[model samples]
Target: MYGHRKNISDVRTPDRFSYPPSPSPSSYSTSSGKSTSGRSRVRGAARSVAGVFVACFTPPEEDTHHHSSSVYGGVSDTFSSTSDFSGASDSTDGRKRGTARGIYGTRNDSTHMKEPGSVKFTIAEIHYATKNFALALKVGQGGFGTVYKGQLQDGTLVAVKRAKKIMYDNSIGGEFQSEIQALSKVEHLNLVKCYGYLQHGEERIIVVEYVPNGTLREHLDCIKGDVLSFASRLDIAIDVAHAITYLHTYTDHPIIHRDIKSSNILLTEKLRAKVADFGFARLAADVESGQTHVSTQVKGTAGYLDPEYLRTYQLTEKSDVYSFGILLVELVTGRRPIEAKRELKERVTARWAMKKFTDGFAISVLDPKLEKSEANGLAIEKILELALQCVHSHRRNRPIMRRCAEVLWNIRKDYKELLD
Candidate 1:
């Protein structure tokens, strides 16, 4: 329910999600500036990228020679335009064809890939599952289209994302494919699971496991009732961190979740948070060991986007950390990331939380309903401190998601002890 409305257009709208690019030498440089070496390493990475990229079936695209970083310091949000290449797609006569390179380095002629655990439901079956797209079953709305609450023949409940179809438009077609590429390959307790998808004519729908509870954002909203306790918030934090850590470190192919906000964090009936919506996820494989960041356009919710990433487009795992930091602030304060209704300085929760935290008034940012129990006080302060560090200006200063999770885990344990 926390998902955003995604579009197939590149007109700078909310749903026009773009893929992360492997940083080209001309496009990205370190804080120390190593342009000469950076280019040389990326050239090698290109070869490696081609090999793996071939195996991951996505729409194919010719190379995008976007070198727009020369302007605005070193931060180039070049792919923010309609001309942006989606890395894996090409526009020909129109209907985008899915392509793949199989295990033996042999190219497969099949338009669709059929890997184990990768399932495709018939259009008829999906129609029945979604109850013919009944309005009553609509669970959420986004740029992508309406999300429906569905049930399969076996009584398995699912969340079906009915993507907005465009006539002869190629942009959203690629976004839909990129989303499937990442979600189909990776699995983690903290990540949403994609069950299958259906392509019925121009209509595209992705079916995923339906999480019973709403989004973390909904839970945080006071209007939704004071349902989240301090412990629950901490648990959500750890869950998000673990999910991001899994994408960063545990995956065979590391992923960078370009969009990480409370809205993308869904809760199960148990309130276990699962990171959903891989609309902006990027494979971190094409990067060289030394050039860990991917160069992509700055595309994310305003307040959660990393200041460093926005300026540099040098997207790293740290970018996710920055967004997660904002999420932590949300948990701590029960506020939205961007609050236009608030005062000027307090408009951004992260910035507001940081000022308050650094000034030794971090306690002031706590949710009013948290009750300020003596036991959770110190732990809450520690969490706020960690979140402050995560939002540090320099990406280098932020702790990795795993480290963030460990700290939260410890705090949760202590909180549990206090409850006991």
Candidate 2:
């Protein structure tokens, strides 16, 4: 789905010492055992950022407290491990919940959903909605799972996401439940709503409100003549920025969306963006008021991964900023993040556009399908400038999500002022 598949060279699997992975698309089973991708020999500076999550988590075979487990990749069996969600925030000072304005603010009032297993739907109801997972209802597929269009008894449409393995009874269930917990307490206009979930026999199904329009990636690369206007693309970018701002600043604690990419963003009839797939979301610790980052093994799609985070293994909210920067480049250029069929210099859109942008040809990156005008051209320049800052090699140079949203909102306002 990323693009035309070609033979990719082996880069080696991840390192086990990085710590056991939890349930979610990024999960890795303890059975996989050991990792040595040449990256392990990274210079001494790399050890300084080698992550702290390992202290709180250990592979089941090595620890007496854990049960054996596996997810799509697999997860840790212990509840106290990173496999389960738990962080302390004692108070909510900003952001609201369940609405657009102050959603992350709801932390002060959240009921604190402690049990994901409790939020369940019946399998029969799932069958009634998805018509028993008929091929016609299928909408998407990937390493994580398959998504299908479905309708509930009340006639409300929904999206049903099923596990890759038909019978994912035990270890994989960790990820199933982890996703539920992540989606349980929070609600936001820019977030995909989780209606509930169902489990029968070996099958685990997640039910979320259906957004009819399709993924942002599909809209960006449509084969038909239908083209997304420059204004429309700008709006989509703002919507996603707002959603990430909500996640980072609101909630009981900051939630790091390990994977932030165009394909994960779903669009509605209005083409509004909604962030989905929280299986890899992790709670930012509230142990200290000044905590700037969490140490965790690198886990995310290749093209969008943050270079700083990848080298140091010190995860931070800015990592998402770097990935969002890639999404911005995609929106402007209409190119896949990692297109290999092209020349090496042109393969990575970020690098290609960055070089062009530095040479003062940033305008060349705008999607040709979009109409041009003086006002829009100025707006596009500002967007590209912000994007370059986001993809900065050093995390300190990247703008925070809230600031990014505010900047995009100002760019939107420029359109109205210019019209007047």
Candidate 3:
């Protein structure tokens, strides 16, 4: 539990959190000496939530008396002395020696001190925010854990995911650490932002920027018995593709989002897609020499699993591509990846769609809810072609994330021009 208290300002009501006013654009400058005038214009236009602040820090150099308060609101909490603090480099350790605070307020060797920019959340604070994991706050449940909606004392909303018993007890903390490390390294508009993480007793919690719109699966199926518009579907596809492209090609280590399904894709209030759920994701160990395969247990939703990769247990970025293809099929056809309505042999929608496409009966497989407009027909065909290319049985035959992103972007661009 956290042990700390400070005077609270009485400027706002309990429902309205208050954040410190941000610096003006004229007051900011980039490391490149560029003024942040244009950047500020965009940022200033965003809806400001009370009590949320994004603070950047710089660790002191060696032998510098770096006096700092506890990172999480000066809270004093106990952590296991055996916890690994290997994330810091030798130089950072030398500088932070005797001045760093571990999770809660447990003092540790400077070696356990993390570099600046790594997020740290207090376990007691999160428990208070989520009302001790109240059932009403539960948003979604997955293989790894249940996600709950929370609000900080400042009233900033967040989504906190508590790892399941199996993942927490069996993984030796690797799963949570891996997710924090991977998410911290990447930043994209279409990817969910991880605010911080905490480890308390047997509980592991990840704090992320909350998306209010809900999951793609829920919007597609729960809201109405109708398929999404071609343009909206294409936009979601493009956003997700861009996010994946950022992970695979732009990062220091290529990341494979092992699970790529509607349920894992979240929508924002603006309907923009944000890819979530990194429990099954993995970062390619070597960036220069791409991995051909990775050995792991067969993991993934039934219909979305890549047949070749599942059989071989050899994973690569292509595995993600294949899963995305199944998702695309679901978007276009309005059918579950594995529809039990079909004959026993043709139950899998991907296999059935492929067969239908080959027989020149693709239109018959299109979601009936989608109107037979010219634009809709063209969009379906274009997306179907891309999906087919992605789900090609041969892993090498699948396009990389960059290509997939480009294709989707171009489709969106063309559709926009048509509308204009």
Pick the lDDT winner. Answer: 2
RMSD of 1: 15.0
Worst 10 residues of 1 by lDDT: 88-97
Q: Model 3 — TM-score against the truth? A: 0.68
Per-residue C-alpha lDDT of model 3 across residues 1-420, encoded as one tens digit per residue: 011112223222122232234333223221222234532321332122111111001111222222111111111111111121212111110001122222112211222124311567787788788998899998766545777889877776778878766655444365567677777766677777677788777878888767787777766775723346767778898888878777766665567777677877888767888887665567653423332455554445555666565545555777788888888888877777766688953556665654454343556567776666555554555566567666655566567766777767666665566566
Task: TM-score for candidate 1, please give it.
Answer: 0.72
Q: Give candidate 2's whole-model lDDT.
A: 0.61
Score candidate 1 by lDDT.
0.61
Comparing 2 and 3 on TM-score, the stronger one: 2
Looking at model 3, the pairs that clash are 18-51, 19-51, 77-105, 294-315
lDDT of 1 by residue, 4-91 (tens): 1122122211212222233321233312222445433323222222111111111113332221111001122222223322222121
Ranking by lDDT: 2, 1, 3
Position 125, candidate 2: lDDT: 84
Candidate 2: which stretches are off by over 4 Å? 1-118, 166-174, 223-225, 287-291
